[model samples]
Target: MRDFHLLIDVGNTFLKWGLFQPSAAGGARENRLESGHALLEEIPALPAQFAKYPAPSRIVISNVAGTRVRAATIRVLEVWPDAPAPYWLVPQAEQCGVKNSYRNPAQLGADRWAALIGARWLLGPRAAMVVVCGTATTIDFLSADGVFKGGTIMPGVGLMLRSLHEGTAALPDQGGEFDEYPTQTVDAIASGCQHAQAGAIERMYAHEASHVRDLTCLVSGGAARAVTPRLAIPFQYHENLVLEGLYRVSMSL
Candidate 1:
């Protein structure tokens, strides 16, 4: 079998992965093989899922879940001793065609960095706003010239709901249906949280539009479905966006 690359995106809520056959001429979409996600705690069991395929030639990872998850990821690689050392994605001043504008570039999350690269790879010179809704919501602006213009971090749908339930004594932990005017407390909480997410993205999009023409909005992550419907502007949903970015980074290496 041909050698392939393994890409992993470790977010705060889950560990997402993808297998890419770079030797394949079909580009990133066609290069992808088996891909799936598991909760952070399920990292140890990943080897079994990977066992069916031969050892990858390269393993690239973007981990924002912290040191413990990083250690767990390393341990999971014990199954493929022959695979080359994993290349952990660290934010730099510039990488993979995207320039990081963060005051301290290294402070940017690895997953977000990868997503920015993926957006550039997918969109070329187009201006875009990359919104990732997972444990947290991030709306980053990327210029047509490929410069990352920084973004906002806010509570995601789940985080907002969880916070409301935890912080308030009356609101329940579960979500209710979204409504223009929510009658029940649960529905009101759900609508407010989801709308908050959509509102932020819209505001960011409006801001980016004033400076850059023809902006594209890219949305991804687990909670994307819950928030996308509430969005008033146009958007393209990208599943496993961070994983795709990782693949793009691997290609540069």
Candidate 2:
């Protein structure tokens, strides 16, 4: 019998879902589908996205919010009423063939867990740095030995911009394209935010390299496209690392 997998990544602002059929090698199925929602309330509609495909035998979720986590659980149960309760992928000692390297493994963010798992799969067993820029920008370093060394978290592009406006008196609420170089104050704020994030990751990449060589940087998250082009170093973007990790976890069990 074929195995069906459902992967869900619930972030601060969005919930990303990926559906796949397990192949013989325990990798993703050939016909994969991806979708997402902005509101947590819309979670109940999740099953509709996979209605055309086969029902998933296993479900994996990585949720950041407790309330949303509860909501997601309910939604999944409602959708797969007949299936077993979905597995919540928390930061554990071992998962998806990767061992947790943190001192307190449980403290590691689920999103980070997904990134490390996806990074190992994408960059092989080599030392790698994964940068996820979204609601918050996180730069995680995975040693050459496949151990997750640690990572840094900072205000993301949108959060930084919103904070500047809310916290400051002179700065106005401004927005611009992240692709173009800034010419004016608004553009400057936009570019500054983008460059600052990209610069931080570049510096982190360099810092990680002082101890480990041949480090591969993998960038992902919603704001990945905005900051990726500004970085001085070469990196690969995985738009759905969390979702991909969830899929991998489902295959494991």
Candidate 3:
């Protein structure tokens, strides 16, 4: 079987992965063999996804999900006939030209660290603010000098909306389109949640823009689209920020 690369990014609620064929040095890069996402509980499809590519020569994973989900991921890998050596990328004080500002590097989520590296490497040194919106929302900062200034984490749109349902009797636990003025309760919930998510990000972005010159804000994660259009400040949406970071780490490895 031809050798390839595998990138797995496990978040709170989803597992995203990619299979890639190697590229020529400093030349045009080939795209991934396949890239897709699946909810953690929908993991039964793992075998099909794995069958889409050749056995990987390199396998790097960043898993923030706890032991149960990690076990689930490993079980998925068990189906591979030629299982490659897997490296679970962990948080470090610094790596791949980026410095860590977390007082205890181990406390930093590997996924978050990877995103920062991905941002710095993808976007040349300018101040960077990373917004990852998934089951949770994280807003983190990075100085132009490659220091990984710590970030903020909060419940995501789904959680926030569910909170209302769980706490109150009338609010339904469902999502709707974002609207400035909503005629229905669901839309109102969606608007309020989106505004809240957007507000937190803007607050951080505003602060960074105030302190840094020519700042770059990068937003990623599954729920990114939910709040991105509402961003009051300029930003860029990267669908595979974590994968990009994983690729960066792979290169160094």
lDDT (Cα, tens digit) per residue for candidate 3, span 1-253 = 4666788999988899987666634211245667788988887778776775566788899999888888888888876767776889988888987899888897899899888888888776788999989898989888889988788999999999999999998998886777899999999998999999999999888887987999999999899988899998999888878888888887777
Off by over 4 Å in 2: 1-3, 24-31, 47-54, 178-183
lDDT tens digits, residues 144-192, model 1?
A: 9999989888888888888888987787979599999999998998899
What lDDT would each prediction earn against the true structure?
0.89, 0.77, 0.84
TM-score: which is higher, 2 or 3?
Answer: 3
Clashing pairs in 2: none
TM-score versus the correct structure, for each prediction: 0.96, 0.89, 0.93
Q: Distance from true position, residue 240, model 3, in Å? A: 1.5
Best by lDDT: 1
What's the lDDT for residue 187 in model 3?
Answer: 92
What TM-score does prediction 2 earn? 0.89
- In model 3, the worst 10-residue window by lDDT is 22-31
Q: Write the per-residue lDDT of candidate 2 for residues 1-253, one digit (tens) a residue.
A: 2556677788877777766776645444344644555556676666676456556687788888677566764665565556667788789987766778888898898988987887886677799888888889999888767788778899999898898889988776666665465677777788889889988998988888788878888889998887888999879877777777776777677
Clashing pairs in 3: none
**Where does model 3 exceed 4 Å of error?**
24-30
